[model samples]
Target: MRRTLTAALSIAMVVALSGCTLVSTLAAGDTPTDTPTPEITGSGDSTTDPSPPDDGGSDVDGSGDDGAGDGPPAIPSDVPLALGEAGEIEGRGGNPVGTFQVDGVTTGFDDCVEPEEGLSYVQVDLTITAEDDLAAEEGSLDYATSFALFLLYVKGPNGEYLGDWLGHECVPSSEWIDDVGPGESATGSVWMSVQTPVDEGLIEWRYGHQNFVVPFP
Candidate 1:
């Protein structure tokens, strides 16, 4: 009986140890799993940014933002050319008499003479060419004589007559061209002083009943 009791006690102790080991294994298996870490590529501020606005800036052709065409208006091919333009005028016998161009315009007085009160001297650089055919018919270009016959009429921007020619007193005499033969050209300066300064106006070259209006600079 003593032996049997001892053996029973030993068996109970072994069972208790085995149960403890099984409990430990089950507890370890039931533990909550750890979550995986996300992959980080770049630095801070990972949120996606918004796109930029489209301002109507200059175009590839260098036009304005308004998309208007290129530079100044196209000059008409008529007899009276615009400022800094050249054209020919038909004279007697239905032939082109001469080609004229207003090269430039100058204002203010030099050391030689002063302009009248409320007036300023405006000098127009004129270039006139007479081809061989016209020069043969009307003789050579005599500026001192024929220039007055051109009947140059100056008008303000509002079509008001500026005044008569101020004469060649202002410009140097050496700059004057008295004549030009066939196949030749003459360049001279014409001066005028108006009571009101001419900002933009028309210089009409009138002869007989025909007139050609040229714009001022």
Candidate 2:
């Protein structure tokens, strides 16, 4: 129980520290009945934000509509992201968010606030790069995606999940040091911890209306 609450609190701190815009769902017009999200709200700055479709937020797939896609707009649906592979998405500000990769997941960080007992806090080494969209194909990704925040969760073998605007289960500690400008790249540490009891499971990046899974032990 300590691990669970501690993990939730730890990630909650990250959400507070990072300049993340609190969103109900990370994607477009749709819902994940099983996902738990954070209660913290964003700074109310939707400008250039890759927010949910319900917020009058524009789609990130370069489609003018509100991301009313059958699958995720950025990547094809159900395509799991492998370690070191980059998943790209365009922001609303005409800036493309690229080099979005999950480097690695680590636990038992010495600097973590959790007590060294039961399950320990997990950390995901992440990279979110902001790219220049000036050269983008005409009318392509006009909203040019920028790095806002990526919601995360851990999926059990049975398909159960946790974290974010709902409750902290496998939330990422992705508070950036500064705003990632075009042509600039930044690596943020994402934290995760499972409350229902398993650490070694599939980690999913809840991007907009789609989930890009990461195979992890």
Top of the candidates by TM-score: 1
CA lDDT, every model vs. true structure: 0.61, 0.55
Local lDDT at 29 for model 2:
45
Question: Candidate 1, residues 1-217: lDDT per residue as tens digits?
Answer: 9999999999999999999998998988876478778988777763765865577663767655664644322332224677667667444444666676777766554433544566666667778776666543543332221334235556787768885467536556676444444567888877766666666787766432245677776
lDDT by residue (tens digit), candidate 2, 157-201: 555664322234344344522345567788766555544445566
- After superposition of all CA atoms, the RMSD between model 1 and the true structure is 16.5
Best by lDDT: 1
Global CA lDDT of candidate 2, please?
A: 0.55
Candidate 1: Cα lDDT at 66: 67
What ranges in model 2 sit over 4 Å off? 1-76, 90-97, 108-110, 114-120, 134-145, 164-181
Could you tell me the lDDT of residue 94 within candidate 1? 48
